[model samples]
Target: MEDSNGSGRGPTVQDVAARAGVSISAVSRAFTPGASISKKTKERVFDAANALGYTPNLVARSLATHRSGIVGLVMGDIRNPYYPEVVDALSRRLATHGFRTMLTTVWGDITVDDVAPSLVQSRVDGAIIASIADADRLGELLYKNGAAVMLFNRSAATSDKLSSVRCENVEGGRSVANYLLDKGFSRLAYIAGVEHIYTTQEREAGFVGRLMERGVQLFAREHGDYTYKGGFDAALRLATADTRPEAIFCANDITAIGAIDGVRAAGLRVPEDISIVGFDDIELASWPPYGLTTVRQDKAALIESCVDVLVEQIRSGQRTRHIQLVPVSIVERTSVR
Candidate 1:
């Protein structure tokens, strides 16, 4: 039997249905998950499908179900070691649930606006926006187009259209502050990530707020822009200043690692001259060279929660907003005195 295309390519669903002595809808239902079809008919359809070497076309199935079975993972900086871990775990989890991940990187010349249309066109059932500086527009576009959108590791203040799963950034910051203060470091400095991002603002607020509560003030603040070079430069400047801080808290692990090198370049010893702490305990944080005292965001818990929320939204065809905050804890190491 010829395919619908009449190219004699191979056996199609139509041929399978004919060979099984069933309607096309019966064959389709037999292959669909949780679809209601009688056991005898399903067995017949499967036997015919096997004999004809008929494989269901995902594209055609998507057209009929209006679900692409694709989840778009939008990110800005894939270079960060932290994000790669997230991607790996997230992709694996999504696969177990019978979904595929489509990675879309928006950075440098490629803005969110440029990619939003293509993602929508791809008919993605859901999206997880991970670590984008400006995700409001993209989130709005996807939400309006009937796709479930969840912000991973970030939040939007003004937009109520998106769901999010992130760590308790404020609490994490407070923990770091208390840890440093308990170490008897009076003069404390902060190395911030991107200034406009919500994570940066919340973390700084928690850290500084706790410091104020303890009758102390932030000694200095520097912008690291969440980059290695940015962190290094900021640390160098802070270290060379006339009145240097006794301890510095970086926003993330990459920044903290860079700050370590920066302190050494300024001829200072870690925890001996200036105690350093970081957030997000990435794999590199535990290394011997940079045993960073940092706040550990539970990556596994975060991904599990994120996937659960997004999949529920996709399956239910509901865009109910949810914001989940995974708890964070401090990991003590040699970096802090």
Candidate 2:
């Protein structure tokens, strides 16, 4: 195969073996981590490899072992700050366990089922998806293809057939409602992420449901499309409306920042003119400019649970059907009254 430098080819394992005065199997053992090779032989193999620019072909090794040592990570909404953390943690943790991550982007219009056919050919031991348009159909497809799968940050409604790791979004939202109401926020508004997003739906239900029990109606609602600019525009419209909301609950931290900016642009003081609360306590939420009050989803717990589920399914060659929920807590800052 032609290399990036447009060379015909590069050094092979056999060349290293010959230069090191060792057999091919010896060279292989030296390269394999935790393989039973003498220190001297390993040093010799490395010296020869460095001199000849020979690197082991992982694809060929996987072919011989019947294990790809790779995991597919499919996700959308790359713009969200939360997702980049997810990707980085998964890649780092998986590497320590000797697995590589193959990231695949799924468009909003595409479902997991549409991508399954291609995944089957890639021969990945397992996959972890951040979201799915049709969970029930994709669950069946993965089962049929004999691939173990885990869903993250969302759960399937069709059945409890899929494994998942997510935060307690509903309870988190309810807690926000309780906190805001206790602080005497009578005219509350909601800044939604997306109409159909599972987390947003669950959170909205919890927040609105709590208000209903208190005999207080929601003052306003706006859809932010789970984006910063969406929140900015939505906040502007809400601020200019006839009945301005006293408090606003944002779906995520980025949106909250945008809303804060919007409120400022409209010459409104935070917590004085309009108190704001947001979910997902991203790094920027605590910045001096925003200092957003938010609910914190435990990123460390979520990432660990996902890795555990995927690894168990891959190593056991069986589905555990485990569902893990990481708890969320409110982090109070200056954004709220």
- Candidate 2 lDDT by residue in tens digits, 1-337: 6742345678778778888999999998876543678889989999999987787888888688666777888877778887888899998988766678888776677666567777777777777878546655665566567767788888877766678889999998899999999998899999998776788899999899999988889899999987899888888888888889989999888888899998888888887889899998888899998999999999899989888778878777788688888999999999997
**What TM-score against the true fold does each predicted structure earn?**
0.88, 0.85
Q: Which one wins on TM-score? A: 1
Q: Compared with the true structure, what per-residue lDDT tens digits does model 1 show for residues 1-337?
A: 6654467798888889999999999999887644678989999999999887888898889998988889999987777788889998999998866688999998778888789889999999999997775797888888988999999988876698899999999999998889889878889999999787788888999999999999999999999988888889999999999999999999899999999999999999997999899999999999999899999999999999999889889988888889989999999999988
Output the number of the lDDT-best candidate. Answer: 1
Deviating ranges (above 4 Å) for candidate 2: 1-54, 108-114
lDDT of 1 at 315: 83
**Candidate 1 local Cα displacement, residue 260, angstroms:** 0.5
RMSD of each: 3.6, 4.1
Which pairs in model 2 have colliding backbones? none
For the record, the alpha-carbon RMSD of candidate 1 to the native fold, in angstroms, is 3.6
